[model samples]
Target: MLSSYNNNKVIYSGTGRRKTSIARVKLIPGSGKLIINGLPGESYLQFSPNYLRISCAPLNILGLHKEYDIYVKTQGGGLTGQADAIRLGLAKALCSVNPENRITLKSEGLLRRDARIKERKKYGLRKARKAPQYSKR
Candidate 1:
């Protein structure tokens, strides 16, 4: 028999990764807000608005009109990458909240890590694909 006391206990935990960033997220029933390493979301925003927007997309997609009040600690990447990581983390966290939502989130490609990144420049190439100055003899 299941114990009634365990009803509200945490049922899921998930990790999200994007680029070089990793986001550890925890989801609980509550209004949406982001806490990064104990700092409020606003603090992070002061550094990068793009991060805040990308990180918040998951909540909106889940029809969580109000904020979910997420707590995240991310490392090893820039603001944009961290935000993308957090979005992935939050989506995974949501799946734990309700497995039924997985299909919808997956369909939106929220679960997939973006593989696009800057290609390395060749020694003689001006850029990844651009050629160096051409001199006609």
Candidate 2:
């Protein structure tokens, strides 16, 4: 849907963001391999099994988990954000393959980008909106 596609090109790609994490995803017809950056999906998401689940949820939702390979490069934010970004990216790439999937993806809430982000700490405040506790004299 982002253009730059051709009959010779067998890859569909999409960009996704969550919090501070940004993921670039490419979907290729292959044997369900998920490679992130330079690491295998599991190795890349070693902290928790949830990350792997999150990354593959979209494909699983559509029962296409074994039909395509997911290639992703993600940066910024924590692991959760990266996982979620990957999920969103995967959903988009799937959409490129079949626009009909959009409704199901949307119904499953995969295509929506999570927008929650950490608020910046202000110069005079202890944190984004928190201030030092006042002690009355």
Candidate 3:
């Protein structure tokens, strides 16, 4: 939600969350390049094609993939969660660029935040729902 002008350059930003992961995304006008946590996105994502694709899905859908540089600072989740968070964040940033883009992004379901998260573990259970086996003596 941080949109501002830096030296006459417009910056659009958005925040995303998935599971325990959170991503802060900034969109700046430039060739398509992704930087995450001060590292190149490709390397940070471990060169995974799937991760790369998921993170860039929104831009591709709008055919504006090459018009913006993505800068992200993500934490608190694994790669999968982080990738998804990035996708959502990017979609939001794109929407701020142009309101019309929301229709397409929303239709494709890119704007929806995944709400599934780890359930809280109960004190009597070994996990969120798993219980210790009962003895049948």
Model 2 TM-score, 2 decimals: 0.92
Rank ordering of all candidates by lDDT, starting from the highest: 3, 2, 1
1-137 per-residue lDDT for model 3 (tens digits): 54999888799999999999999999999999999999999999999999999999999889998999999999997999999999999999999999999999999999999999999999999999999999999
* Deviation in Å, model 3, residue 74 alpha carbon: 0.7
After TM-score superposition, the amount by which residue 75's alpha carbon in candidate 3 deviates from its true location, in angstroms, is: 0.8
TM-score of each candidate? 0.76, 0.92, 0.96
Q: Considering TM-score, where higher is better, how would the candidates rank from best to worst?
A: 3, 2, 1
Winner on TM-score between 1 and 3 is 3
TM-score of 1: 0.76
Model 3 lowest lDDT segment of ten: 1-10
Question: Considering only N, C-alpha and C atoms within 3 Å, which residue pairs clash in candidate 3?
Answer: none
Model 1, global lDDT: 0.76
Most accurate candidate by TM-score:
3
lDDT of 2 by residue, 29-60 (tens): 87999999988999889957788889999999
Q: lDDT: which candidate is best?
A: 3
